[model samples]
Target: MGQNTNIRGIVQAAVAMTTVGTLTAVSATVSRYPVYGGQAVRYAVAAVILLGVARLRGPRPGPSARWEWPLLAALAATGLAGFNVCIVEGTRYTSPATIGTVVGSVPVVLAVAAPLMEGRRPAARIVAAAAVVTAGAALANGLGGGSLPGLLLALGALAGEVCFSLLALPLLPRLGAVRVSAYSAAAAVPMLLAAGLAVDGTSVLRVPTRGEVAGLGYLSLVVTAGAFIVWYDALGRIGADRAGLFAGLIPVSAVATTMVLGLRSPGMAELGGALLVGLGVIVGLRRSAERPLAVAAPADHHDPAHDEEGHQDQAHDDQHPEDRRFVAEKAADHGV
Candidate 1:
């Protein structure tokens, strides 16, 4: 059952990232549209779809603590709005490949940072695999020259990508994936709209051309709403470090998308990079007999410490939930 869950998570993460990669193709259609305003509209549409899905899925817990709200806001502000802004501005001063190569380092960041944040040592095997993934992603993207400003903006985008997953780890236990995706998408709309107003002025919300509308629809329904849920759900199942490995697929998928569109044919370098990405993901996801599960209980499992009424024992709430879950899973694995 555990192995099956991990496999499902892997599939989910791969599909989500691949879908995101196709955004490279779709983005051209909306390239002329005002970035902030277009993104605002895209996210607003996504928010509605996600909210509708969440409602149909039945009642789940909402944010109880004040701190979760801020985290969610940060997730929207930095991960969604700021990330797009960085990419748009960065490309003005640098090649897209330059920015992409910089952001390609996400696997390594997540491999090290996720474990450390949970107060565990990073797994040596996973760290090595992450390095391979990053290299593969860079090769796939190819290096390009960029101004210092573009490099800095790329770094900012990288930070945003990392925060998108890490910030949601704590919230998954309570709110699940759908609500978090919905709330963040909803929250991002206002931020993007405000930026649009300040930047694009009265022209911010003009009617989009048919092609632009189609692009926005794809970005909203598939990339934002669908991918967000799958990615977050994968994070819950596989943990961030494992799921992060799939991010390497982004560039590989982008290459494939272009090939299919007949925009470009990938050379030997791109093909080789795709092979490396597969290799890295396979190596990173291998289960170690000696290493412990990152999260103690399966995300779907009811918290043994919490009752049906959703009341938690004081002790459980005081300690970091990840640590507690780790302890619980460890005990179960050992037949304690």
Candidate 2:
């Protein structure tokens, strides 16, 4: 089971890297459509596909009380809307390489933030792996010139990603990944549409070329639909911190894609970075594999050590209900 989980995590990482890597290739099609409008379409189509799949393969959508709607809306705003807009707009003022370097640090942020927010020290290996990944991403992108506005916008994208992972981790237990992803995408449609109107207005309504339409379909079906489902599935299976580390593979994959397309060959530095990313992933998996599995006992079965741990965890949750809830849910999901 542990081996299978690790393999699945690797697969998820590969999927995410491919999804982001394809973005560069699709830029020509993306340019043909209004940024916000194109994103709105991509997300809307993905939402419909996910919703349809959910209706067929899963239970009804109701998970909790009405209060969750606000959280869902927030996910839509930040994860779906803000992430896309920030990256798109940021590139206008800065190079894509700069944006890649900035956004690649998200895994490192999650590695640090996960432990602190949960009131525990992060494992040394996880931190080390994150650092290696971050270094690899920087090497892949290089320390190039970038404007202040572009840097800030790149940070916004990073922030949006942090919110997406941190916020969605807890909610996965309640709503499950498919439902949460669908709801978030559905909710973001209006926001994207509104932004599109405010920015490009009727230009968004213009007919797109065949290549552009195909690109939108790829974004909707493959990147958003396939990528998100696999991403959250990995999150649920392996936990968010480990899943986040997989993001370091983005630059590596992007470089590989570039090479495949004969756009440009990777120099020694890029090759070295790719090796580092692969090494980082291996280190991350080692950390994950080192974690002892939790075997849950029946409620009636009383073991002093387990009971004490449970009480301590409960007390921790009581002290900080919001942040600790994610830890609790993640534990429960793992049957810890």
Candidate 3:
């Protein structure tokens, strides 16, 4: 493995774990504030906190460039709107365990997309690693226990996540992580509010409990604002493939948290599934280091964790001859 790729692999691993952790925390909190409008309110609040931080530290988003608006739209669609709605609705339709399994496929998506989008091919080792991750996720979902729709909902969430990762690419380099997060977060509010108003008019006036308020505060201040900066910065440096891998951590955290809250203990299948994902990530990432041209920027120069690839080119076409032929055309040179 080249030193550069090795570092990126580590970054992606960390981000993936953190991503899962954030989801576990936020989702548990959401049990308190289930309203549709809550999405916007939380992000709006988070954006404010991010902006405050931006003022104190230098902003991650620089003067900026062309990729801002489209990236913002992507964030609004994937992160703010679709992501929230899907999770809530999906949960209503299916089981969280099943959904977690399906959502876990993101690493596979990235594993496939990375090569094709980069206008290159993935090392055989990477493909193997991705396959392992995919299989592990399937095992987790299948054994974790849920209905068919439950599985589908999980897949749906994964679909949204894939879209979010691909779409967020273009914005990272120009905006920096924090600026992009804050802007998209702020931008998402109007739509969230509209959804709430359209679906439930009294959403605005509903009384919030102490837990709900605290949940909202955490979602906004910590999850949306704080985590995003770190995540986006990771995305910018390491490329989405590595960043997406962070997703595996979510199920692990969820299971652990569930146990902690005394909701349920991790089942054998879930544990096996999580272990599979962890193994797959380790294999794929380490293999990436060994392969030539595996990451965006040289890891030695910049933190491998930085996101460098354009979000649009997030696929790892190494195994997918079935993928669209022109994926590479839109690809930005990562870490150049």
Candidate 4:
């Protein structure tokens, strides 16, 4: 069951990143739209769809604590809205390759941070694999020069990307992936709209052209809504350290997307980078030779199978004491 869960997580994470990669092709169509306003609409639509799906899936709890609200807002502000804004503005001062190379280091950051955050030592195998993945991603993107401001913005984006997964961990056990996705996406809309009004003025919103509409539709429906759920679900199943390795697939998928669109063909470096990404992921996912100690959950903390939307109950039961304490305290504060 554990192996099966990991496989599902790998596949889901891969699909989610690949879907995000396809955005490179569609983003051009919406390039002329007001960045903040368009993203507001995109996330708004995604929130609605995710909420609907969550409803259909059956009733579940939401963030009940005041702190949880802020956490979700932070996730939206940093990960969703702020990340997009940084990418848009960063491109003005830097090559996309520069930003891509910087953001591509997310795996290494997560591999190290996620374990530490969970009160465990970072797995050597995963950290080494993450380095391999980052190197490959950098090679695929091709290191490029950027201004100081652009470098900073790219770093900001990297932080946002890391937070996108890590922040969701505390919420996942109770809220599940769908609710967290829905709530965070919903939280982002107002923030983006406010930014739009500030940055783009009253002209922030206008009816999009037909092509832009199509592009927004795809982004809202597939890239934002579907991918967010899948990514979060995978994170819950595999843990962030393991799931982070699949981020290397983003550049690989982007290259493949470009090839499919006949926009460009893969060069030797790109092909080699893709191989490294595959190899790194394989290495990271392998069972460690020394299994870490698993802290037993409190007897009273029984989780129904449906509560976490198919999250492996055994996995939750085996969480480190620190993890359980964190969740328990949060749940108590939330009146859950």
User: Which candidate comes out best when scored by lDDT?
Assistant: 1
Q: What is the C-alpha lDDT of each candidate?
A: 0.86, 0.75, 0.64, 0.85
- TM-score of each candidate? 0.88, 0.83, 0.76, 0.88
Worst 10 residues of 2 by lDDT: 292-301
- Return the candidate ranking by lDDT, descending: 1, 4, 2, 3
Q: Write the per-residue lDDT of candidate 1 for residues 1-336, one digit (tens) a residue.
A: 256676778888999999999999888889899889999999999999999997897766677668888999999999999898888889999999999999999999999999898777798899899989989999999967799999999999999999999998887777778888999999999998888888889788889999998999999999999999999988877779888999999999999999999999998888988998999999998867535333422333444346345345543653455657788988899999
TM-score of 3: 0.76
How many backbone overlaps does candidate 3 show? 27
lDDT per residue for candidate 3 within 248-301, as digits (tens), equals 666666666667778777778778977987897777556333333234432223
Per-residue lDDT of model 4, residues 191-222, tens digit only: 98988998899988999999999999999999
Residue range 198-245, candidate 2, lDDT tens digits: 889877656778888898999899888888777777765555666777
Descending-TM-score candidate ranking: 1, 4, 2, 3
* Clash total of candidate 4: 0
Best-fitting candidate, scored by TM-score: 1
